[model samples]
Target: MPEAYWLYEDGIGEARATLIDDDRILAARIELPGRLRVGTVARARLTEFQLATLDTGEQVMLDRRPPGVTLGSAITVEVVREAIPEPGRAKRARGRMTDATPATGPNLLARITATGVPVRTLRAHEPDLLEQAGWSEVLDEALFGEIAFAGGALRMSPTPAMTLFDVDGDGPLDVLAERAAVAVAHAIRRHGIGGSIGVDFPSVTGKATRQAVAAAIDAHLALPFERTAVNGFGFMQIVRPRPRASLPELLRDDLAAASTRAALRQIERVPATAPNRHRLSGPVGACLDAHPDWLDELVRRTGRTPIFNA
Candidate 1:
């Protein structure tokens, strides 16, 4: 289990993300953040569409269509495996002897090999989910909304626990809110970001505007997730139960080094591994400690750990 951020420079972009393995990222999709400048930095929690093989072959990265995005009737299944050759006896060299293991199997064996699922297989599996998820009108609405020309980018970070949508805007807060709220909801399905989600809409003070924005949030999130009131701080919170990081994050991190840098800001949530369970890390933890009562709250919320580090 690898943890920490990776930075990409030179020909590649630099961003923070959770490097899951040598080649996989557990953070947001950095490459797709709209209108990249020569040196713009973005942080994200990646989403992925994956097909894992029983033989531990290649993990296919698919475009994670939002829940109500699209689903054709037919689906295809792709399988990749190496033909295992029958076991052969190894010849000993005059100076060296090497033990040979049987190379016979149904899939390829290599120090490194990659495989993927067929596209048709992926397409066929969407309808039943659509039916179960009650997605008819939702799909129609999204299709209609997608045609308008507005320039801004929104990305989703879907964890099993929560979804955090970071909206990068080139427009006013009003425009960003309307478009982004919808986009976040769409992304919820696309990336299947569920659980408790905190949508960070650009802060606004106008009462009517807030109300309108709240209504938009409710309308967009009605079906897939239960909408909670926008908190006092204007955070539109919703909950949609989901699995894990979706597709885009998986690929960018796997293919390049940009994903790791996108995650350093969030690593504090994981809690440091330390010997003192009573301690906490980061500003939030420090604040809690300053106030004895809040410190008690922290203890109540998270069980004591033997070790802690900032």
Candidate 2:
């Protein structure tokens, strides 16, 4: 197995943790300030049941309503998935009743340490390891959800029902399907995507070819996921443990927030001695001002207060 390590950067608006294997980013994680994270155990009241179905396509209306759980009752719960922001209405986060003690969930770095991976923390004064590894390229893939591979690319669309991938390219039919399957797997890891995922691959005839497509995903993606075989129509669905919002979800849901984080990252890269070291404008400046803590952190790292026209 190739040795893997995590390059962690504590940024202003977010803290990023990336898994590096063979000198490339194998996976990425981003955590925003004060968000209710996955694995967070806390006492909560049993609110109204959601009208939506679970990622597994199972009806959850009466499922979470087991023996002792009653509506409007106090119950200890653990967050399973964060709230999904749709066009107009947002989907409330999904949670399940838990018996564990109430405690704050692990942060990005904490989660990486829990996996026993060696980590090298990056300081602002130190060399830009993440940038050298194509951080902007990865974020672009997540923000746009168009990820290119050898023969083709996968267009990832995050819907309220599930995240969908459309594999479009030109190549040998069987080879394209197999390659798309692997590319989808890598995109899932690279973007920290989880929950219900669907991939529509090009039609393939032979059963072995279909199996090969599925095998490619199994070989590339790590375990802790359940998937259905490639069906007759060349569609496969995967369900993974979605404890929090994925990287794509974070970037696509809010343009201003994403811009704010990007602005902060840019400011961090400038030398403190520069005349315009901490300058921001437009939505990024306004968004940054709303979050005093993040702005304070930016100053703490760069040693300069921001100049903005918010």
Candidate 3:
């Protein structure tokens, strides 16, 4: 099968590149805010035991501290966990100070290019291809957690402790469970879901049938994960390492926030001679309205007041 890649930039400093196998998106690399992505080295100051703040204003929890390190002492640390944004709180990272320097190499785009895969910039084709791929629906599903397959559906709910998947649908129990297993695997990878996950498949009576479902999961899913066999109660548990927040967690709770930021970025890109009229979605307009300071800053920077339409 031929592989292709699509790179998209929101023109607002955010970028994402997706790897496509034929028409299906197999994986994606997204750029997130903050400098504390996995494998990045940063200078930090210890504020408390095993906890320190980075120069980027992100707090970090250290796995191990250097010998003789004192409070408020500057030290170099490698990021083991990317910053996860939470509502009404500061984003924090997890890392440890080691003697090794951070390794630098090809990024996702460059590595894909080295493979000679056909890569397309989606800046121009974004509207058409994104719609055709049902990208918005995919985003919605990742955020809201309802996924439909041919024979069944999976409901995902992420919590502080673990992420849960409940499978339900019509058709033969064996077939439905098999299909649901495959779908669950895809959803887990596509949404960047990690950490502990539980899938409640439709219970199958025979041992052979449950084994078949497990085989299907093994065949369809990728590596670097540990999972339990499906039990008689139709429950399977999976554990994947999570270095960062899933894409849904990054975008879901703050879509309006992202939209407002995108709008401001678009405004900055607009030519000074262009008309001051700008259109915004209802939610985006409300978000901007809630922050008059942002609008005032935009006016001060662009020297043009924008007329917003909901």
Candidate 4:
């Protein structure tokens, strides 16, 4: 374990946070605009409830049903888990009924600062410390869920139930399984994935190999998680506290938003001394036009109005 600090960068429609350790990204988080963040205290209406499934519609689940805060009651709840959007639907944002003062939670920068860890803020004029650290490659992995390691690769799929890591590669599956286990742990931290996680090793892998693979995950990942032993099927499930959407879920659930923000980041990265006025086309351009404030921000940064193609 090396001394780790956070890198914070402001982008269009999002705040990016990366945990840098040993000159690479150890973990990362993306704070999308309009998200109901964790640790926020707000007044919410208790619309519905069930045994374990809550349908608050506000996408907030109270930590526990308060004694007097029944359905249809207006109450204050401190957010526990932010809303998570998956392929077809979204998960509720979870909160606990609270009597604390109502206030918006700390934003990404604030949250990172509260960690008592050193934070390096990247400004437009500052050298692109983030890009130099393979930020785009991490984003691509989040979008595609494909991670290639030296000996193997892991394909992570975030379903409504759990995020699945299917290990793939050639030759000596048991060896590959162990190697893939390491990669899986790396991907888990790098992509900020939590909640239920399933890792699938080659089925034919021996029992001893399965245990070894499980051990690999334990050795690589930090503690504070509960995991089931690798079964005969080579499947192991690990559960972590999921407070918000993982990097892949944020990028994959809605590609239009992802593309829009990515385009803005690209445009923002242009040299401050570059020529005035730029041309943007297709969906990216259209998405910008759809959000005038974002476009105005771009204009402010680049000092030129954009030319839209079509």
Candidate 5:
């Protein structure tokens, strides 16, 4: 399948770059502000022996503070894990303070283009082919619980420990299980869902059919993940490495917060002469209105107060 990149700006300071393989979104990169991402090198003040929060408000948990470092002392740290945003809490990372700075690597977009994939920037008004191909709906479905396939539906729930997927429908047990397996794998990849995952597939009697379900998972999902075969109770466990927040965590944990942040990002990208207008949904508008400091910052940065329509 031919691969292409879709770079999107939602016109309120938020931008996302999605890599699509034919119709499926293989990966997505979202711009997050005020957080330290993996590979970021910066000087940080040690708040405690093993924890230091950066100037960007991202807290980093270190293996050990530098030998001579004391609380409130400045130390250089390299981010090993990006911050994962959680509800009503600050994003946190895992890193270490070291004396030497490591070489910085290419960013997400640069790395994608380095592989010779074609990239296309999408404006807010432009039509996205990937969205037309059901990828957008998939993202929405992921945010909610109902991810519908042709014959069945997958309900995904993320807990504090792991993500759970429950499959259901009226189709043949084996057929529905196979389809749900593929859908579960797709959801895992599309949402960047990582860590431990449990899938409750429809019960299939034959051992070969159960193995086939596991094979479907292997065929559709990406690598670097280990999964157990379907057991007698029709349950499978998968372990995947998580380096950042999943899409569901970003969008569903706090929809209003996410939309408000996106609006701020859009305002930053507005051209000086372009009227500086923004239209937001009712909830997002309320979120922005509740925070006068953000509006003040927007005005200060752009020199033009945006005309907001709710």
Candidate 6:
């Protein structure tokens, strides 16, 4: 199988795929799976200048400019032509497959201090994932700890793109909204969730309720999330981190959680209200759903009548 690698040179980024032989570059670039080829190269226009020392032990002038590099700009530099890496060589030089571990797995680490809440930390395994989603430095900051629920509770409900929050005065909903919103931001930062999030505040039947929710949400996000005016419907639409999986999905495997083992004796004994039930029962139903087989095959495996659930 061919493998693609990113190439960065002369301030230009290109994706190069090593052919199956891992020797010659494929020239007939129509399209290939998992491959990146140069589509278009745009040059960046140079402006202001900076003086720097080069590898030749000589001072050199370099270009520094605002709106510097665009889709196409030729950066003048020496080009060294070399063949692709051999399969053996490439195998020996590959970077870490997953990322380096820092502390633990996919959960938060925290310790409370006497003078207010001290600080919280993440397990070591979260850094690479956070970095991949553009949240490396953000996690390092102390501001993240402020977003945890402080003398309050937070409610989270899942949505397709973003999770929705309803702030009831249950326990400082405003502050909870801010904290949960920040957690959502971090979730989005850790995973990429992009779209709209709706935050419903309890009907405050008074002025300033909508603005308060909006301000709280705004303060929690590390990135820009635009909002429309509160609609007549009395629901505030919040734009927070739109990430791939909510925190729960990232934490557990659905398949393992769904599996339940039951012995045939236990399954055959479940109470059935039918007048003359001679077919499959509760445990059999589970087995049929999970592992379907021919009717004869099923009978051979577990000599029990297959009861179809109405």
Candidate 3 per-residue C-alpha lDDT over 83-121 given as tens digits, one digit per residue, 9 for 90 to 100: 765556535778888666645324445645676777766
lDDT of 2 at 92: 63
Of the two candidates 3 and 6, the one with more favorable TM-score, higher being better, is 3
**Could you tell me the lDDT of residue 83 within candidate 1?**
16
Q: Which stretches of candidate 2 lie above 4 Å from their native place?
A: 46-63, 66-73, 277-281, 308-310
Clashes per candidate, residues 3 or more apart or on different chains: 50, 0, 0, 1, 4, 17
Runs with alpha carbons beyond 4 Å of true place in candidate 3: 65-68, 86-91, 100-118, 125-127, 258-282, 289-306
Cα lDDT tens digits, model 2, 131-182, are 8888888888888888999999899998878899999999798999999999
Q: Write the per-residue lDDT of candidate 6 for residues 1-310, one digit (tens) a residue.
A: 2242211111001111111113221110011112111111112122223332223322222323323444223333211111111223311110111122322111111101121322222222223222232222222221122222344333444444444554433454445444544454444433323456665544444346556655655665556677765444546665643312322222221222111111222233333443324445455455445654333443444445545552
Residue 258 local lDDT, model 4? 82
| Candidate 5 structure quality by residue, lDDT tens digits, 20-47 | 7676676655555545566777777899
The candidate maximizing lDDT is 4
Q: Give one digit per residue, the lDDT tens place, for model 1 in 102-148.
A: 12222111111122211111111133322233232222222222212
Error of 6 at 120 (Å): 14
Ranking by lDDT: 4, 2, 5, 3, 1, 6
TM-score, every prediction: 0.33, 0.86, 0.80, 0.90, 0.78, 0.30
Query: After superposition, which runs of candidate 1 have C-alpha atoms over 4 Å from their true positions?
Result: 1-149, 158-161, 243-245, 248-310
Candidates in order: C-alpha RMSD to true structure: 22.7, 4.7, 4.6, 3.1, 4.6, 21.3
Off by over 4 Å in 6: 1-152, 171-193, 232-234, 240-243, 252-310
Best by TM-score: 4
How many clashes does the backbone of model 1 have?
50
Q: Tell me the tens digit of each residue's lDDT in model 4 across 1-310.
A: 3388888988878899898887788888889777777887876677766212223345576666667556777777788888888767777777787789888878989988998889988887778877777888899999888899877788888888999999888988888888888898889889988999999888755667788988899999987788998888878999987888899998887687788887787777777676545556576667776788998887888777755554
Q: Which runs of model 4 end up more than 4 angstroms from their true locations? A: 1-3, 49-59, 276-281
A best-first ranking of the candidates according to their TM-score comes to: 4, 2, 3, 5, 1, 6
Global lDDT of each candidate: 0.37, 0.79, 0.74, 0.81, 0.75, 0.32
